[model samples]
Target: MSLEIVDSCVGCFACEPLCPNKAISAVMQPGEPLFFINPDKCTECLGDHDLPQCAEICPIEGAIVDEYGEALNPLGSLTGIPLHLLEQMREAECRQ
Candidate 1:
């Protein structure tokens, strides 16, 4: 499974350091700034812990999700972010 931070994120930077794989990154946007988790670096904390550290620390609910765009199940979770969203974000960033 993977994770993606939605636009609802307030850029609180709360989920940044919590990522064990150091996947989360702070990006400055035009309107509202937010954090982006690098799918390549993201491991969903699977090998490190039973839960995704970023999700665990995220104060905002529904901010993270799996490849199916469903909320990540905190129960014995895996690592990485959804390939689709990750690619989208990467492409968006590149265009910026």
Candidate 2:
């Protein structure tokens, strides 16, 4: 299945070069904020790697989702911070 970089992406640019099929590219323009994956060109690294290179390298959890809209990199996959902790921090931040 093809992969999609959701709005949660931090635009770290870590996944661009790792793609063997050159499917991933920057979506940056004058005011654009993040990168995007080309579904037409994306193959989920099927023939080139064991897992999708974009998902493997992306540091943001829940940023990269599969065709079915499921996150490929779940909590604790990138950063060591757990989902619960992150949620707590976010809630606290909002209260600030």
Candidate 3:
């Protein structure tokens, strides 16, 4: 199974080097921002590590998703960020 880096990825470099398979690549295209993981190369660290390194190290919630496109790091799991606060922030951004 492969992990997908969703749009919520803020171009963080945290997940790059940690990838044992070297599947993660920094994508800095003018319009396409964020690091990308090559699904063909990604092994989810299955044979290397017990957990997917990217998901374990990602600071932002809902940034990394599984093969089924469900976020592995759902809201507030590691960061303890309140769901309401995130919703409010999104709403505020929409107003701007």
Candidate 4:
């Protein structure tokens, strides 16, 4: 299994060099400028590291995901904000 980089990726290149397997790459397709993880080459860093280095280094939440489409770095993970509190803040913003 491999982590897939979604559109949310900002092409920051932070996760590229961190990949232990060299599975991550930059995709230059029009309107699709983002990093991609080669599934064939990806091993989820099982034997390499304790965690997936790409996901651990990614700055954007929900950018890297598992084969099942679950984000490795879900929202509120890197921000240190609880999901429920973040949701409440969003709701408050909408009411304003």
Clashes of 1: 7
TM-score of each: 0.67, 0.86, 0.89, 0.79
**lDDT ranking of the models:** 3, 4, 2, 1
* Candidate 2 displacement at residue 69 in angstroms: 1.0
Between prediction 2 and prediction 3, the one with superior lDDT is 3
Candidate 1 residue 60 C-alpha distance from true site, Å? 1.1
> Which residue runs does candidate 4 get wrong by more than 4 Å?
29-32, 82-96
**What Cα-based lDDT does every candidate model obtain?**
0.75, 0.86, 0.90, 0.87
Query: On residues 1-96, what C-alpha lDDT tens digit does candidate 1 reach at each position?
Result: 468888767888877877788888988889777888887888889889998887777765467887788765432243356767667876999999
* Model 2, span 1-96: residue lDDT tens: 589999988888899999998988897867665788888999998879998888887888899998899999887777888778988998999999
Instruction: Please give, for residues 2-96, the per-residue lDDT of candidate 4 as tens digits.
Output: 77988888988888888888998887878656787899999999999999898888888788889999999888989999999989998999999
Better of 2 and 4 by lDDT: 4
Candidate 2 matches the true fold with a TM-score of 0.86
* Clashing pairs in model 1, backbone N/Cα/C closer than 3 A: 2-80, 2-81, 3-81, 43-79, 43-80, 44-79, 44-80
- For all predictions, the C-alpha RMSD in Å is 10.5, 1.7, 1.6, 3.0
lDDT of 3 by residue, 61-95 (tens): 88999988888889879878788998899999999
Model 2 per-residue lDDT at 55? 87
The 10-residue segment of model 2 with minimum total lDDT is 27-36
Q: In model 3, which regions exceed 4 Å deviation?
A: 31-33
Name the candidate that leads on lDDT: 3
Q: Which ranges of candidate 1 are over 4 A from the true structure? A: 73-96
